[model samples]
Target: MTVFGCRICDTALTVPVSRVALPVHANQKYGNGPGSLAPALEPGTFAVNPLPSGSPWRRWAELEAGEAEALGWYAPRFSISAGPVGQVLLAPGDVHGAVIDPALVGDSACCGLDGGEPNMVCVTCGAPVAIRIDDCGLRQATWLDPLTTHVLEDGPGPHPVLDWADLIDQRPGIPPSEPGGGWHPMWAAAAASALAHLLAASGGDPISIPNHQVAKVFRPTLDRLLDPGSTGPERTLVLAGPDIPDTGGHFALIPEHPQTGELWPVAPPVKPIPLAWDAWRYLAFHRTPKPVGRSVPIPPEALPALLPGHRFEPDGQIFLSVLARLPEVRQPRLRAIYDRGRPYSYTYCSF
Candidate 1:
């Protein structure tokens, strides 16, 4: 296990946290009531139409499963699965050996604290140490920013390497889905956070999201933020990693090491789009339910579809907070991209 501490004061901020097997995706909610159903669909089987509500086909639908399977959904996206995975928790207090800054605590709509920013500072030096993102509905805990904190190797012996395949293979029973709540709030929050990282990774270049399904969720904000007039080479976002065969791509959204938080690089070295380890793992291994028109029924021997349009609006505050922490956001060209997209707004919604 590794102990994380404040960089400035070297104050031991957290205990040696290890990866624990979880019955569901860390971000997904498995409520005890009748409404919360686990997402049950294969990855890349669905496509989303990100157009406005006025558009005729704004809902999500299954891709031609045979073709999608053959082509492998040549876009960078995540799957929603009803399976078991691993997660880590870093709570505040003596039990976890964490010392959070009382002054740095920020209020959250759902929970009392929002750690998307450098909200947790070092008690000794007052320098930002980590982000504590335990809000209501979210798996409450703190995430130590690798840039601001140092992880020290300690404990009895070397920690066991967390095997991605093992975690993926484990299966847990599906959870109940909420009747009215179609979109998972935590999923939206995590996706919004990932979108911020993707933009910063773009380096002011036009990013091409091949799969319209995933693109629909992000394109609204991206189209507004990216420079249309720029002649820079276009970069395509592809999902490539150990499970998915890398058929040569410019950029990738790869998985992260569960225990260490180190990103697993895509083969051949393409620009990487960062995502939370659980998010990436779920996307890589599980199938997400596709949104369909209300009357449509599940197709036989093919991907399932559902009614109502699913919309994902990147939280403005979360986007800005994450963007500010990234060094790439400082580049003049990247800054121009943000500036050109005046009046930032994410309005993709599902009924």
Candidate 2:
């Protein structure tokens, strides 16, 4: 079989051919999708100008590397600590470019790659360097598993090209109104890149992710809201839509319970407007790629019934899903809120 690949890099000694032609197409390629690849690609012949100082892109790269390295130190609480039998820990979110699976649920050794190997070359740049693949025997390490959503231990650093997954039940958590660490777009982008890198590294394996690992990356807004020192207006609730444009809607996130007067806390004790699947799917898919930190529209009629003294503005266009009862919403005809700001972008709505 003619297993083609770019020759600017080297090949595995165990492979059929020890030396392949230069810049030939490879056996696989992982597009910008779930379960991608993270092979050590050879650097190219040419050198490009460096990025400007303190650019967001530069910071993002550092955050990505930091998050990946952080996985190396994470310990799996689910694994039997009696002693190390044979084990291997995988981080699929690091490998896959998308968040196909989040949270750790169980343990296994093999994971299925969504699109298999990546063979495509980066047209923007070229490679010219020596490369070789060796059977790096597994070392005892810890990482997050995308499929099982757990943290587990396995053989040493830099495992061989093996598809691994842990056998564990999936425990899906309620999707958060604000994904990533915080509501800011920059923070979301950085966190998403790191999380995506972690998933991609796992090769979509089923593994256990420890609670500490989740807490390390997850910044619960609830914590901030409860902090008595926080000044200014706090954020308490969020309303979002799905990736689908026409299906978007909004809801208010409230604490488990409200205390004191109508002047409610804005940041901490927050969740999304209680919505069913129809409304949720729309918000989940249509909501912006990053949280915009905006609130749902409180109709003039409902305003009186809502928390008093708080001003409510129809922030963005509510893409009401046809499948559910239309939210009792009325937008100001003469003025538009969505027109003044960017709308949320979601994966489902891309099509």
Best by lDDT: 1
**Model 1 per-residue lDDT at 101:** 71
Give model 2's TM-score versus the native structure: 0.18
In the order shown, what is each candidate's alpha-carbon RMSD? Answer: 15.5, 23.5
By TM-score, the best candidate is 1
Each model's lDDT: 0.49, 0.21
> How does residue 97 of candidate 2 score in lDDT?
18
Stretches > 4 Å off in candidate 2: 1-4, 7-227, 236-351
Provide TM-scores for the models: 0.51, 0.18
Model 1 off-target regions past 4 Å? 1-160, 171-182, 267-269, 288-308, 336-351
lDDT of 2 by residue, 10-96 (tens): 221111111111110011121222332332122111111111111112222334433422322121111112211212122221222
Question: Residue 78 in model 1: shift from native, Å?
Answer: 34
Candidate 1: tens digits of C-alpha lDDT, residues 1-351: 556676677887754544332212333332323232222212111111111111122111444444323322221112212111111234443123344676666554343454545566766677776555545434444545555566565453234554666645653212112357464544454565667678777767888877454465567767777778878898888776557876566778765554445666765558776554555555555555655675776553245322125554555534543454466665776555444332442322110
Q: How many residue pairs clash in each candidate?
A: 16, 81
